[model samples]
Target: MVTIAKANAELWVFPLSGPTGGSGITAVDVIVVDIEDSDGRAGTGFSYVLGGGGATVAAAARDMLERFVAGQETVPPQALWRRLAGSLNRLGRGYGYLAIAAIDVATWDLHAKRLDMPLYSALGGVARTLPVYGSGGFGPTQDPDAAVARSLEYAGMGCTAVKLRVAGAPADLDRIRAVADALPDGVDIMADANEKCDLARAQWLVNALADVNALWLEEPLPAHDTNGFATLAANSPVPIATGEHHQGVVELVPLMQARAVSVVQPDLAMMGGITESLRVAHVAEHYNLVVSPHFLPALFIHVAGAAPSIRWMEDFPLLEPLFDNPVGMDADGNISPPDTPGHGIQWAHGARQEYRIAE
Candidate 1:
């Protein structure tokens, strides 16, 4: 009879060290959710928007808590997720899904804590290490020499793979080639166009990527461009990757079924938390596609433990500064989930006070 006793949501904004690679994202707006049971146990969860929109997301989170979460029994996390999602049938899935994501994560955390088990274990997974790829070294307009230097730094740190941002320009090919040439043998290179290219440009980039023996080309076209992705993938030399902007399983199915994507990268918040994210991973496994979640390896490490398709985790470091003790890449360029109960993420002391925005 452990019922939910209280729930709260807050908005926090953190400025990036600099504009992010490709997207030029300058800040992140995090909506934090906390849920407590009648027995006084508590759990925490969060979702974020890349540039801005903290207030809207936070408000939606609050409304969800009031309408659907309060006074509910501590049922299974998936059950709560379905209820939350069903409530949004008419409201549409845009910001509502983000709001549901925060609540769903909090529910899972509380459920795992109640069982006195780590999140991965609660999800029927054993702790294991997954390969990590270095990301965020090369921006779209960065100098080739600087990009090569950063790639070398990541390689020196034991990264087996590195990702660079690419524009649809001719010079982009040379930039990727330069980085590839500088890296040691056995290390791999990946490129992200951030949905900046058209069909023809994407086709050109994929062929060039193959010439360099690159691993894959991510988001060469907009996420919804299924026709373009299908067309490009059919003729492209390199594997095509996408899914960060495709929302949930509904949006991802077409891309996967069309064989348009060789790798599926699910964003935790965008997928409405771990439950749905795992669903995406399992579906990818069905299609023999690789599952490389977008950013937050510290969090996705848990998902990787359960989902066999997730072989690589991106080390983007977007939200690491907010956590007191985030997981780090090992000497072998891999990261493992913490054995502690729940997700094992703790906010830095005074982080909430420093970043919280008033309503």
Candidate 2:
């Protein structure tokens, strides 16, 4: 008989000194939700620890949370979402989704804590595992030697596949060649343009990399350009993947219908949380599309594991250090959902004071 009382956001900016090939991400804020029930047990939810441009998202979440769930019963995720539909006017879809996401995760955490079960087990406990490709820690157009070394390191770390970032068409080809050449025979090499290319250049990159046996090409064009995306999806020699940045399930309905993307990569934080992601997975399933849950590896992994429709899971072996009990990958290349109760992360051993407050 407890009710929700409060919420907050946290940013974890663990500095990476080595720089590596992973681009400009110096830190990430794992958005944390503070919830006080009538019984006095406080539960926290972790959203995507988005670095770089995600600070705005953290700033925008609190107002929405206060208006929606500060004094309500820790209800079903759907009930929380129902409040969202009505309150979304002040907070637009993207930020609104992030706000809802923090609370949804908190609700799931609260539910699991109440039931004394792990999040995965509550979601239909399956002894399921999936193949994971190496992701993160690579960037757009790095030194040729550095790129090759980086790709090889991931392959050596038991990853079945590795992804690299590509930029302009000329640099794109070189990046593909460097990483592709570095991988072992059976390991697949994938590339993401990170919304860097136009349709024609994207087509060129895909066609040019035909010799590399790349598993997929991700976000060559900006995420919103569905027609351009479809054009690339249809023409690219590589399998086209998109959807990490989209905000709602409605946005995905058209993309699925048009076959604009090869992999549907809805992130848990941005795609309206696990509830909405499940809906998107069904839509992708209906269209014969491959659903790849992007980023926030822990949350997305559960969504992927729970849904029968999903095919591949993105792996970020580099991101393990931030969590006190960060989830790990198994021999089959899949991450085992945390066995502990809830979404499964405790603050790391030396977690920064109150979740990495930035200026």
Best model number under lDDT:
1
Q: In model 2, where do residues sit more than 4 Å from their true spots?
A: 5-7, 10-23, 48-56, 317-320
- Regions of candidate 1 where Cα sits further than 4 Å from its true position: none
lDDT of 1 by residue, 1-359 (tens): 88899999999999888788789989999999999999998989999998787799899999989988888888899998898889889988888888878888888888889899999998888897988899966798788899999898888888999999998788897788899899999789999999999999999899899988889999999889999999999999899999999788999999999999999999888889888999999999999999999998888888888899999999888889999888889888889999889998889999999999988
Against the unseen true structure, what C-alpha lDDT does each candidate score? Answer: 0.90, 0.72
Question: Can you list the residue pairs that collide in candidate 1?
Answer: none
Clashing pairs in 2: 11-29, 12-29, 29-49, 324-348
Question: Which model scores highest in TM-score?
Answer: 1
What RMSD, rounded to one decimal, does every model reach?
0.9, 2.7
- Models 1 onward score TM values of 0.98, 0.89
Candidate 1, poorest ten consecutive residues by summed lDDT = 135-144
